[model samples]
Target: MSPNRALQRNISFYDATNPQEALGGVVQNGSITEANFLDILGILLVVDGVSPLRAQGRMSNHIVSRRDVPLKTGVYNIYCDASIQISNEPWIQRLVSRFAYREKDTFRREISNRDRKCVISGIVNPESSIQAGNWAGFKAAHIFPLEREGHWIQYDYGRWITDMDDAPRSSKISSSQNGILLLAHVHQVFQQYLISVNPDDGYKVVVFDLDRFGLDGKILDPLCRSPDDPHHASDELLRWHFRQSVLANMRGAGEPIFEHDFPPETDMVGEILAGHYGQERFDLDITDRLR
Candidate 1:
């Protein structure tokens, strides 16, 4: 959502920092980073489950080449430290990396322990990648987001503990309750309000298309239910996410939404579904499949 820029500046527009400042660009040469060719909207744009990598190639200069470093057992394109935290490379911005490292260390591990793996990424062996911090392309993303009672809420959920013997409300705002481990691409779209996870009757994925671009779609259901952990995706949190991504915005708000949580599927009327060789409408020949 484009909040009135007149009211705020840096990072006010969704996960975007600033339209004028197309961050995340690393210049190969002094003259060109992908920043020269993009804006914030273009940076966050996704098409068919992938961001536009073609534009990145178009800006690549022949003179600017990357030096090859010796491989260090990388997985998920991340390398972890001994603490199972994804170690940050020099490339990540200092200010941002500081907080992210904390998130990577604690958030990733906590959610993995509770949910048992990356919920959205579906990595069966997420543990193997954790020790190496070379995760299998998953991110410990905040569900409610990092805004101050605006597009999202600015709650520091990192320090939340599972033992709710003291304060029950603390666990409610914890990332372990509302946050999720999504694939990098999935996290990107999620941060930008492109998709949401619905965890009611069954796990369901919802996508939003504000521009009518038909980018809306679904992936495999996340299917997470941690009975042991007090901090899995709460139904309240899921509805909040849906309201942000669907109901209050692009998709119809009045639409009766449910994650297949309604009453059990009913069989179609047997006689009406039956086929008849005779012209008489009531002369029915029901098959076992209809039973």
Candidate 2:
């Protein structure tokens, strides 16, 4: 099946110290020790949905080239060990892998799990009412969207740099603490504010502008909500990312802004929706297929 190479991660060995490092060059000399190879194989199975033996088999030549005894069975052992370690703390690994695969749905789920409601309005609705039955208030937002070139290779003094062209594509979905959960409407407003108010800062979305616009974009102080909310601050690194990738479009007026979370409590999707609103977190009762 074409070696099922498509299912393998593109991580490199050089950046292996971190869980989210690229896997492209990491499978050095087309090889890894039997133990390490097994670890990789298992990781592929668990993280990418590949069969354990099949994943190892794909790396047969590489393992043979680099190690003395590169058996798929041995490799499977290593793969299992790595899978256990990764499963214990999966957010980072999941983020890295999701970014690597451009699994947009995974990205949305991760963010939703972390912060389930829209901070803009503070209203939590049922998941069914949120994104037209997607989630109460969850949508996949690109810290550095593929539509725009949002990928980073490494950090330079607590800042991410886009130097790794080969590695850049692997980082498409690496989650940053700087990223935020907003209603789709607020997400759109945040982008518009990026172009109109903070063009100087580049295309990255920032809390400062949204905090200024509030949920509905009435130009009220956006930070009127809890200032201590971790998402309230600007992320310099993400801004740098946007600056590198976001192309300024000095074109027609953008979409309308959702300027008011007047109800004072809302979910991400509720913020996008309009009409008489209330404060309640519904059960969503969504089917598995919807999730």
lDDT of 2 at 73: 24
Taking all chains together, each candidate's TM-score versus the true structure is 0.40, 0.30
lDDT of 2 by residue, 137-176 (tens): 3444444433222213232222332222343344533442
Candidate lDDT values, in order: 0.37, 0.32
Query: Deviation in angstroms for 111 in model 2?
Result: 0.4
For candidate 2, what is the lDDT? 0.32
Q: State how far residue 129 of model 1 sits from its true place (Å).
A: 2.1
User: What's the residue-level lDDT of 159 in candidate 2?
Assistant: 36
| C-alpha positional error of residue 65 in candidate 2 after TM-score superposition, expressed in Å | 67
Q: Which RMSD values do the candidates have, in order?
A: 22.6, 21.2
For each candidate, how many residue pairs have backbone atoms clashing (under 3 Å)? 6, 30
lDDT of 1 by residue, 1-291 (tens): 122112211111111222232222211111122232232223233333333322212122122113222111111111112112111221100111112223535566776655555565455545566566565666666676432212222343333334443654433444566577766666665654546654532444544323122223333324444555466555566655654443222211111111111234533233223422122212211211121
Q: How well does candidate 2 match the true structure, expressed as C-alpha RMSD? A: 21.2
